[model samples]
Target: MGDVIRTVKVKLDVRRERCDDLHQTKDQFLHCANTTAEWAWRHPDEYCVTSKQKAETALYDRLRDETELTANLVQKGIRRAIEATKSGVARLKNGETTSQPHFDAWSVVYDKRSATFHRDHVSLSTVNGRIECPYVLPDDPEQTPIGEYLLNEDYEFRMSTLQYDRSSGEFYLHARMRRAEREEHEQSTTAFSDAEHRTVLGVDLNVDGSLAVTSTGAFIGNADEMNHRRREFEKTRGSMQQTGTRSAHLSIQSMDDREHRWMQNELHRASNQILEEARDHECTHIAFENLTDIRDRMPGVKRFHAWAFRRLYEYVEYKAEMLGIEIEQVSPAYTSQRCSKCGFTHEENGRSKHQFACQKCEYELNADYNASKNIARKLLKRLHSGQTSSSGGAPCQCALTSGTLNLNGEFIASVDSTAEGESTDKPTTSVVGN
Candidate 1:
């Protein structure tokens, strides 16, 4: 395992009189970052800059002349702007629809030179000067123990962000801390370094039916229940809108809030379920389909359902990282139609919404389950071949609790894919363009 970095979020107890200073600082930082981003976007040559030296050489002086930010804060803003611009440019190059980077959030970055850490309070730089703001730890035990890690000597503080929540009228410091990797975690991760030894959990997400299905034959989340709840919300909202009364509009607002909270809770539970499945199976990695251009791929899916897939992946990603399990995304190109049994490639293979029957090999299984097996195979293929291989190659294998699937996708007793020799040549199964 490598060194671990964690972000600690705790409220900042700031007096009313000092709030304006922070507001001004955040506004200036936003202006600086956006201005720098706009300039970089206009000139891609400048935005391709990655190193701190290049960023300083290109944006440092210009940002300083435009804003009242200090040298350290100005540098931080320039670096942040560079990152945003690079990400946007990369996404655009990848053929993903994206707009120019924009910074509109109420946030300010502080480095060691600009901020000081104390037991009870943090000294932060603002437009006025350095201000000592006490930390407000969460009262609930279930919440993150802010003091447990922040005050520990083993963790070293890094650059952090100061943010304000307009609705709560509270300021927060997202402090980044790092510590060396633990010996036990290193031992566990050493096993992951071996491609053939690693156990992977393949997850398939859907808009209808079950939300997520694993290669291990575990299904999670009820899309029907979620759709029913959403329909009820829509029905209630429509009725309130027809009433056209002030109280009805207020009720509609409350209903929207309630629905959002419920959706978040559902997604969190689904993510937790996925983590449990991976851990139960002793998987080193969890594989998912690449969600880029998901809307185009799933043209019939609603916007909310598409958003749910992305949100669920994000939730699982952070939670999985804590357990030293890695998340991997495989190509979504032929995962559905390609047969996990004989590496057959045909459109009709995934015959229906729920069933997958390969045309060449006559292999049949649940459609999502088959796709999930393909997802796991894609990752395993990449690990063994050092690249993502064509879907028509020798079929990759998967491990189950009682048995493992062979190249033909039969349930025979085995351990890992290495137990059998895989063919380097393509399969005889008829194929179509991917």
Candidate 2:
């Protein structure tokens, strides 16, 4: 087994007094970080001379005295900023564009040495004093204990960031823990699971079918009720915002939190279900469209909420990694309208938003289903050719159309958009990493 990092989010159980203290300290920590980065940015000459250790050593005393933050937290903030500054300088040296990393008063980092976790409570050091907060899982109300990994004695606690969202009035502690993980890449060598035995699950995602269509013939994520609830919330938000009273505003905020959590919970369920499908079928690889900047190209009726598509892709990515399912992003061009039956591209082939009919041949299929097959074909080409770049396919002139929707049909909700893991060209097996 090798090292794998996992982030366990446990809500802080601090009362108002301690919570306020933590918030105040978080502000100071952010200010200290950004301020230090600004210093490094202005003094590029000194950057070459000063190592991260030297920069941190010079800033620690000044930051602690000025910001009233503790030693460890101040040092950590400055160290983080130094790392950012170093990155920016390197980018400039390489003739690449660079921008300074900026931070504000919303979140703070807590090094492993700065906190202690017990069975139920965690004691954290701040500028004021050591505050103890029992962690809480946001959606789970029954006070169910945190995950077993968090409590595992052998797990290494590296560092975590504590952030408070003003809109939801919730505190989140993202604790990153390290454990051992190892997987044998023996599929190609195994006699039972050779080229013929390998299963490639190609998935095509679209607004027409929120549930993705797969090459293996399964549609995932049919949560129309979720969409209905989102539309209702939007309508309610529109009506409520008109009143504009303080109480009405507060009620709206609470409603927004509920809607956001509901959407997140629902999407999590969908991601899990998708992973279960892969696991059950022993899917070795899952292929998806490289939907990076998809909105810029086709801002049409067939695009779902951008956040939903992005979040689903990200969630599926990490979840797939956990199940040892490899993920790759193929070219988005021709995935939607290209005919999988005969590789025909005709405008009339996509007869309707939901149906695809080929003009050259009598081939017909569900629009999304046809698209999924094309995605699978693209993946197969990559596999056989040993190419890693995006597929170099011509764009389809035909467009998938969806009927117009009024205000009621639109889904709107403010939600958490932080991707759990950082994007990487070289994929890693770990669940948590940047």
Candidate 3:
């Protein structure tokens, strides 16, 4: 497998007297970044300074003379500005309204050249000079948070960001770490190379209580809690906006960052849970509903909800790729309304908020779970169709906890119904198709 990059955040033990030096360094870095961003923002027509090489050539020496930041720090600021410019340009091209990127946050990016890691202390470059600061690590490595990422030999050190928490008056270093995938993952991938032996996991994203539901009967995240937090943020922002004070505006920015971090943390947890569920089910691939024109389908969904869905998918996509597992997207059509057991399709089948009951077969299950199974079946059908045309292979079959579904048009389950229509737990075959 290939290398995987992850970030670990650790609190720093900085002397109160030395904290001012770091603050000054952060201020200089912000000034340099904003200066570069302002210059790039002036070029609306040409969309210039989006490239690292062009940005360095145009603003590197100028920032060095204008700010007190060191050479590496100035380069990092330029890189940050270029990334923002590129994002802004892309959004504008997509007909989205966006303003020039601005950096008001109190954070500084540090690369290997500007930072040194020791056993217990880290030396960082500041405006004054290099200062050595101790890490707030526990006595035992196992007791440390993200200890594997911080102290493991397998992880290689990369760039980091220095951030100050105003609420706690603490300095934190978010260290980016890289490591290769485990050998077992490679072996497992090889075992799944045969299409006949492959298993797939399907996930359904929703804005209800559950954020994601997997075909293997696993629910990943809490959408209700996320929506509650979003509402709280909106209420607080509205009150602060009405105040019309500089401190209120600054508080709004800090609150926005906190909310974003919290949302991202939730999404990360959800994505990790999805990966675990896939592994638990021995799934070689994970399938999700295609998100194209999602807004048109679910017009009531808020912008942040759509953003969360996209970000969650991205997190899962990368994590799955690291383990050599493939990700697939299938058409979302009729997934919510179609019955997983009988393949009955009707709009009224999804009448209930949390439960789904097939109008034709009386099949009942959780709505999201039913949709997830349909997503899996759709992907299986698509894959099998291609395989049949190309290699004349056997039909695609996926094993559920209680049954096996053959994409050739039948579902074989261990459970069956008697003459009176009561479940008898006997083997039977059901005709199931799109």
Candidate 4:
């Protein structure tokens, strides 16, 4: 069977007015909670049985009577609230638990503080005969520019963003656009065309500041820089907690925002670099570990784990697609402890902060690099062997080349191809240290 190829691009545009209005809407929804609570208290017996629609209608009526909100706006707000309740219920049934069930959705009603509607070209669908609702673009326009470019020209491009310096009144896009053509023979399908063959590169990322590249037999990069920044952030946070002063709190908040922006930029750069390198190696398919489950492994630190894993995977997947590469995910079982050199399983191999020394085969290497090799090998083996393992160990048998050389006096040249057929050829001679 051949693969399906589709292109999607995203662009983001943030208007200052929209951002401020969104924030105000959020604040108003928070204030409305007291209204809901007071009503629930007065009619405790009816609260549970009252449908969300009925509750919202009654609340709107009371707000209208008090001149807190206009009748038309109140009705619009109620309808939005009802939709939110339905969404919350659906999410709960799907096993997602949250302390703030209906919080965020409630704010959508107030999203447009200053509503504008276009008559000639209707921008939004009329809701209950009211045209002053927040507009959902025909398609998500924020990211549509890139999608249009990719689809229209059948080429890949890089897309990135930069925030405005509000104090300085400076706006910067900082977009690094690189367009590339896929130099492969195209095959026609029933509905569309397909590439002759595709390459899948599996990536394994770790919070310990290392990224595993399955296709290259190399650790792409580590998060040491990020870790350093995080440590600084934590120190500042702790110092602020100790101070307990208003000025200290303000400083801490500023620091937090700055650190967050820095971290986001760094992550974006790292993810882009990874994909760019993969493209250079002619990778057409990109794969990653199923991070949703890997996140569950951190029971107490689930929130942090979820944030890190999701951000990395999301960036990689979207960026890969923008580069005309397909992305997939596989199980993340023992990609680290299993040996890529030999099919030796080291179930009892105790790892330190940096090294993964396999007890069974006495193989030693940087833990993240070893894991990456294992991930690439296992995925390729799965594609070729068509075998499933109940034990959940990463499959061995990646066509990898590795050797240790004495750098004292000899000259050597070598070429090694990974499981995905990515070749690295280098010739070198070494001199002893002076």
My TM-score estimates for the predictions, one after another, are 0.52, 0.47, 0.52, 0.45
Q: Write the per-residue lDDT of candidate 1 for residues 3-103, one digit (tens) a residue.
A: 77889888999999999999988888887787777666754344344454455546654565577666567767877887987787788779887666788
RMSD of each: 20.2, 23.0, 20.8, 20.9
lDDT of 4 at 261: 67
lDDT of 4 at 365: 61
Candidate with more favorable, higher TM-score: 1 or 4: 1
Superposition TM-score, candidate 2 onto the true structure: 0.47
Query: Model 3, 1-434: lDDT tens per residue?
Result: 66688788888999988999999999889888888888888555765568775676567545766776666788789889889988988888899988778998989998666788654668999988899988888666675545777787677677789999999999998888877678744564455354445566788999877898877667779999999999999999999999999999999999988998798889878988888877755676778999767878875578888888887886687567557666778999999999887888999998996788889988887788788888888877776666322122434655454445666556455354123221222212221110
Clashing pairs in 2: 2-181
- Per-residue CA lDDT of model 4 for 37-145, tens digit only, reads 3443322133221254455535743453443332334444444445545554556558886222244332323112113222111111112222322212335443564
Error of 2 at 93 (Å): 50
Question: Runs in model 4 with CA error above 4 Å?
Answer: 1-194, 209-215, 298-302, 349-353, 358-362, 381-434
TM-score of 4: 0.45
lDDT order of candidates, top first: 3, 1, 2, 4
lDDT at position 103, candidate 2: 83
